[model samples]
Target: MADLSKDYMSNSADPKNIQDLTTFVQNLMQQMQDKFQQMSDQIITRIDDMGNRIDDLEKNIADLMTQAGVDEHV
Candidate 1:
């Protein structure tokens, strides 16, 4: 992996400047990570919702088949 800290520090030679740059990059990365996690959670919730919908549809189909007298033995 690339040395992200060094790269983000703009190759600063001064110790204090490098430290400030490092902090800035770290905070920015943390914010991005939080946003990504939120998005992932939302996607998972949506997938679970879709799965529930599919289960309901399956039950409806089974009920319809029963009412139509489709052979249960099959």
Candidate 2:
């Protein structure tokens, strides 16, 4: 069989091929970063919404306690 390594080296030596490979890698990295950023944003939004819901629940519970004439410090 012919020297496959030599053939690969020759093909890889072409500047256009190198540029194309670099561009492909950069684009792939950017896509992955974008996906990660989107996921992070969604996680943060969900956490904030959960915090709001917890706060509302706490407020409602406090209101119920007051209606029953219970002291808050008790």
Candidate 3:
């Protein structure tokens, strides 16, 4: 039977493998952060759009009230 300890020892002593693993983890974390930021930006944009639409609707209602001679302050 072939011994496997030597293989494990050799792999553990290699710094290149560790560096590669570290780089991979860093890239993954960066991608996750970027995606989170993109989603947050989208949510903020939607909220802003909804606010603008609500404002327009309120203005339209006020205009309608004025046309009908309805008192808006009542």
Best by lDDT: 2
Worst 10 residues of 3 by lDDT: 1-10
Maximum-TM-score candidate? 2
- What C-alpha RMSD separates each model from the true structure? 7.6, 1.3, 2.0
How many steric overlaps are in each model, in order? Answer: 0, 0, 0
What's the lDDT for candidate 3? 0.94
**lDDT, candidates in the order shown:** 0.91, 0.97, 0.94
Residue 34 lDDT in model 3?
A: 100
Question: Of the pair 1 and 3, which is ahead by lDDT?
Answer: 3
Off by over 4 Å in 3: none
Q: Residue by residue across 20-73, what tens digits does model 2's lDDT show?
A: 999999999999999999999999999999999999999999999999999999
| Residue pairs with backbone overlap in model 2 | none
lDDT of 3 by residue, 3-46 (tens): 58888778867898889889999999999999999999999999
Query: TM-score-based ranking, best first?
Result: 2, 3, 1
Which of 2 and 3 is the better model by TM-score? Answer: 2
